[model samples]
Target chain A: MPDRSHTRPPRAADLGAFAPIALAALVLALVPLWAGDSRSMMTVVTTGLTFASYAVAFNLIFGATGQLFLCVGALAGIGGFGSVIISDRLGLPFLVTMPMAALLSGLFGAALSWVAVRRSLDTIFTGIVTLAFALSFQSFVLGRPELTGGENGLQVAGGADTLLRQPVEPYYVFLGLLVVFLVVYRVIQRSHVGWAFRALRDDDAAASLAGIDVARYRILAGWIGSMMLGLTGALFAHYRGFVGDTTYAFGSVDVRVLVMLAFGGIGTLLGPVLGAAVFTVMDELLVDQAQVRELIYGVITVILFLSFRQGAVPALTNAVRRLVGADQPPPREASSADTGIG
Target chain B: MVAVLIDGLVLGLQFGMLGVGLTLVYGLGGVVNLAHGQMAVVAAMVAARLMDRGTATALAVAAGILSVVALGVVIDRTLMQPVYRERSEHRVLLGLLLMLGVGFIIDGVLEWRYPIEALSLRITGGPVEVFGVAIRRGSIVASAVIGVVGLALILFFRYTTFGRATRSVIEDEEGARLCGINPGAVRTVIFGLSGGLAGIVAMTQAMTSPVVSTAGVGLTIFALIVAVVGGLGSTSGAFLAGIILGLVNTLSAFYIGTFVSSIILLLAAASTILLRPEGLLRRA
Candidate 1:
């Protein structure tokens, strides 16, 4: 039992990073109640919350650990499809199916990390490899009509109908999940596993030399990340009451996640939350300007990558902290672990 | 089946060009240009429009190639340099995402400007028979052009001092720098040359098949698979792997189904990445 705190001391201001996230969560929790059962607005907020969960899941692997898992949609689709089938056949509730589906998704994520890590390939290679998996998943779902219902997908029986009948219910349910995820994220950030992930992300050789099981931690991060993603996907499946092959299309869901995360921030927990919320609102507001919106999103993605690699949340946090400059913690080297050879 | 083989060969040549171009940049610059396919698409679109509007095919293609070459130089000097200087250990992460962003922007712009339709240039040529096989005469021409270009590349790499210097940088950047080779200059040239190669790809696609603006990601994915399977930074390996993948693609499409070909390609690439990251060709 090595002292994890000695690896990297958790800063007091690390807790300060939570202020914005907490405020954001407060707003998210109130959105459905504020909307007073307006379907369209509820839809938009829930959708944003759904994507925000994904962004959180993504941040675990891609943002925190520097492992690239580009197949979140596919993995989540796997979770969604599994949950729907299980619920239909066994007549189980979400409490039972969601975890089961998450387990399956987690295993898949583990497989993705193993496939890439075993070869000791870079993140770019990992992304390419996972992208292949993503494509194959889509092809599989589409190719098998009997199993997956093909492009039409499987309906969740009365799930979406129930949500529609009670829009505020889903709003609370998903927002609760979002809050749980934020807590989990914070726990990971401050825990021993968090320290290990940070260490592994910073320098694999150095981390491995420090008596840490690099493979173990990397795989652990993958499982955790994908499990979160899987839960979100399962919830989304129930929300839409449909899980089609196109639900995980490369051109649609995958790209959307990338854009959302890149725009908000890659590594920061709050960044993804902010990104998902901002981008979703932007998309909703500019729904009619599809082409222009896509073009703008594309441009912003590039611009953010070039100029603001740390993303919106971190930059703002730093600025706020600098202005206040009260009780400043020791400066930690911004971990450059996520960037690697393509 | 014979037509499949002929078509496969032609496709293989194009795949070879993509692999070579991508790996050249990868080996020398350590930057995988995910936007490589978009550059090709842009050129093809330009050429297709020129031909559509009643311009000479040759002149249109020449103009297209020249335009992409310039675009290549401009991209390297302006866009990519900052990505290169992004000043992080996560250059690959940031770099790939940066290029992907650029790719999407280019795609969006093209789709908006164009009719969002797949446009393929139609060349007027008669069918040709060779070795008791009938094939598209255009396919033969494209294959021959690729063959000559590939050969010229091989010869240039073997005989030219500049090529040797570039090769040196690919082999060992620091060593080449010590040996007085300007790695930066070599990389810039490779970037420009890769763009030229992308222009060739666009032209080939126009002659052989339709290319849409959104097709950049797909094309880049295929090229990435081929390059990875061939060996990330190995040229000859890419050539051989390209042919193998092309032939497999044709057979799969013929026998199983159209979508199955991509599955096989993706599977092959994933397995290669997992089981043999160095690639199966055994570059010696």
Candidate 2:
């Protein structure tokens, strides 16, 4: 890692960058106050938090950098299944297995990024390759019924004695994880890593010309982002006390995260959190219309991609900014503004 | 071994056919239609519904293919218009995401309305002997259909002026425009052609096995693998890669296990990316 301290954002801007994350964390911390009594509501909120973390991680890899990994579910599944298998088969503790699982997932992600970078695959080719990996991972899981329990899923018996299974406890745990993810994201944004990310994302050749190691930064993003996914996945498995096909299936996890990240602003700090919250509420409201739920989601995805390619958050911010009579655009944070292909 | 090889060849032809639609779209527009398989399923469902209503099979199939062609045109006109406005990487990303959403919509609609509907065409005939091996009549007929279509595509692209114009657009859109070619019109025609091809593949697939409503994603994956391996835009390359992957698929399934074949195929595609990003056949 090259010393990039000189490239760090100004202290005021760094602090300003974290303002939204802090606000989001503060608001989300209050979710359990009213919903604590209802087990179902707690589960719903916790699930939302998990998705928010996944979206944040995705934002780092895709929104920050330009690596469009289509295997979000698979990376998370590695964490979920890795921890479960380690704890169950090896009799390891949850604490030991969780980090181990995350590290393993991170390494897998790094390998993937290395391949993409070495091949110089563009966004769509990277997506295709990662999607292939994701599908293969699903097949591997499904094929190895003796190991994975296949469609029946596996029970996390190791965490059965812990408070993780408690309705409200898991919500707080996931909320804390989300906070960690947000803080990590903001810190990265203020550091030289963030500079490299933006530079490479805009134009890798230019970034390389400017002495930024594009491959190193890209692989670093992949590793860190995948670690977040793996950690959250492991935590969720333990919290829910089960891991199944649906838990990390591409449709259930990856698609939802993509929609969420896109719905929020792709590269915005609070986009994932806002998107996850809105979609979670929408999910709850459409619970009665199960058949049409996915259809509605599909329609919304299409409409959202077509109409607000940048997302609702940035659009809303722009509207508010114009209303307040600001002539110049807001200070460029980690944003998708003018994300034209170089 | 010969029997397995023959079976693989049959499967490979279908895979090649599937790849053609996806590869053509990508070559022409730099858009990988994630809904390619969904379009096929939609066509299958249409044909199935018509057949269920006592319509003749030939007429039902024609309607099914035609409906998808119309869908492709509509999508090119409406959904893809915005995608086309974006350039380079953004265009690819937007197109992919939008098509993915379309795929989900198609899947949701098909699953909701026709949960149990499936298309399985039964071509009744005795097993045909080839190289001292008996092959199913359905497989033989399906292979024949694919072969004919493949030949037709080759001829059309090689000799037709429209085909040359289409290739020119894929090669250099701006240059093609300078030469008086309407890239949008060409894309529309190819998209419709791709849709028709997808419908035909679905029909052929049904002759051997049922094409269920839920088969969209799997089919999409297969098409993608074939397209990527064959080289995104090369028609002949698709057939070549398809046969290779199809053999690998069948052989692995036979020798290793049924579950390992897909993984192997995917690994093959991933390695192809590593070794040859342009695919197996470089466009001449």
DockQ (CA atoms), all models: 0.53, 0.52
lDDT of 1 by residue, A37-67 (tens): 6777887888788888888888888877888
- Please, what are the lDDT tens digits per residue for candidate 2 over residues B51-101? 999999989989999999999999999999988888787788778889989
Q: Chain B TM-score in candidate 2, rounded to 2 decimals?
A: 0.98
Local distance difference test scores for all models:
0.75, 0.85
> What lDDT score is found at residue A10 in candidate 2?
64
Q: For residue B142, give model 1's deviation from the true position in Å.
A: 1.9
Q: Can you give the lDDT of residue A186 in candidate 1? A: 72
Quote the positional error of residue A230 for candidate 2 in Å.
1.0
Query: Model 2 over residues A129-186: C-alpha lDDT tens digits?
Result: 9998998998898899899989899988868878898778888788889988989987
- Show model 1 residue runs off by greater than 4 Å: A1-8, A11-21, A33-37, A89-91, A158-165, A309-342, B87-89, B116-118, B282-284
Clashing pairs in 2: none
| Model 1 per-residue lDDT tens digits across residues B1-284 | 88888888888888888888888888876678888888888888888788878999888888878787787777677767765654444555566767777787788788778756565767687787888887777787778878888888878788899989988998888899999998877878888888888888878766777777677877787788888888877888788878888888888889898667778878877887777778777643
